[model samples]
Target: MNTVTRAHLCEAVYQEVGLSRNESSALVESILAEICDELVAGHTVKISSFGTFSVREKGGRIGRNPKTGEEVPIAPRRVLSFRASHVLKDHINHAPASGDNDADGTR
Candidate 1:
C-alpha cells in the first residue's frame, strides 16, 4: 500500500508554491494542528470537495470475548469519523486519464 506522509505534503507544497522546505513543512503542520484542535473541541472540520471530519461519542457497551466466551465491558470514547464529499467520492471511483487506453494503445 502507498501511504502519504507529512514529508510528501511538504514536498508538494514546496513544488507548487515555490516555498522553502522548512516553510512548507511548517505550513503542513499548522494546517494539521488546526484540524486536530477543532476535532478535539467537538467541532466538525469540513473542507469543500474533500471531506468532513467529526468526532462521535460512543456509549459503553457489553461485548463478548470470542475466545473465552466471557462478557466484557467496552469503555465509551470519542471517535473521529470522516465522510467524503461527493466530489471526492467521484474522484476515487473514476479511472485516471492514463488508464483509458486499450492494450493496443488506442485512445
Candidate 2:
C-alpha cells in the first residue's frame, strides 16, 4: 500500500489504542526510521508477523546487453530483501469463507 493508506491504517490503530494522531504519526515515523537505519547499516531486520529486510552482497558479474548482446560488467552491490512472516503470508494466501467478505478486509 501507499504511504497515505499506511498512514490511515496507523491512524486507526492509534484510535483503537487510545493515542492522538500526532502521537501515532510520530510512532510510525520512528518505526520507519528504524527500518531505514537497519538497512543502511547492512543488517537484517525481521518483524515476527510482518516480514524481513536484509542486505545482501552481490558479486561482480558479466551480463549480456539486451539490444546489443554485448558483454557488460556489473559491479558488486548491496541489495535488500523482504520475506513475509507466517501471518502476512497466511493473509496473502487465505481465501474467504464465502459469507460476506472484502478484499484485504477493507469491508
Candidate 3:
C-alpha cells in the first residue's frame, strides 16, 4: 500500500483548486492545526463524509511484558482515535476495483 502525505494532499489541492503550491500547503496545514487544536481540547472533530476524530482517555493498568514474563505498570494516557463516517464507509465499500486483475496476472 502507498502512503499519502501532506505533500500529496497539497499537490491534489493545487491541481483541483488552481492554488499555488505554497498556498495549498498552507491551507492543508491550517486545517490540520485546527483539527489538532480541537482534539487537544478534548473535543471531537467531525468532518462531513469523511470521519470523526476524538481523544480518548485510557486508564492506567497492569500489563505483562513478553519474553521476560515480567509485570509492568502501564501509564494512563490520552489517545487519539478516528471513526469512519457512514458515507466514508459506503464509499470505501463500493469503490470500483482497479483493473489490475487479469487471468494472466498482468495489467
Best by TM-score: 1
In candidate 3, stretches whose alpha carbon ends up further than 4 angstroms from where it belongs are: 97-107
TM-score of each: 0.86, 0.73, 0.84
Per-candidate alpha-carbon RMSD to the true structure = 5.2, 3.4, 4.8
Error of 3 at 42 (Å): 1.2
* Candidate 2 residue pairs in backbone clash: none
**Candidate lDDT (C-alpha), each:** 0.89, 0.81, 0.87
lDDT of 1 by residue, 1-107 (tens): 44667877787798889889999999999999999999999999999999999999999999999999999999999999999999999998997768645423321
Cα lDDT tens digits, model 2, 1-107, are 32346567676668677888888878888888999998999989988888988999999999999999999999999988888888998977886477344334441
Q: How would you encode candidate 3's per-residue C-alpha lDDT over 34-83 as one tens digit per residue?
A: 99999999999999989999899999999999989999999999999999
| lDDT minimum window of 10 residues, candidate 3 | 98-107
User: In angstroms, how far off is 38's CA in candidate 1?
Assistant: 0.4
Q: Looking at model 1, which ten-residue stretch has the lowest summed lDDT?
A: 98-107
Off by over 4 Å in 2: 1-4, 96-107
Indicate whether candidate 1 or candidate 3 has the larger TM-score. 1
Q: Between candidates 2 and 3, which one is better according to TM-score?
A: 3
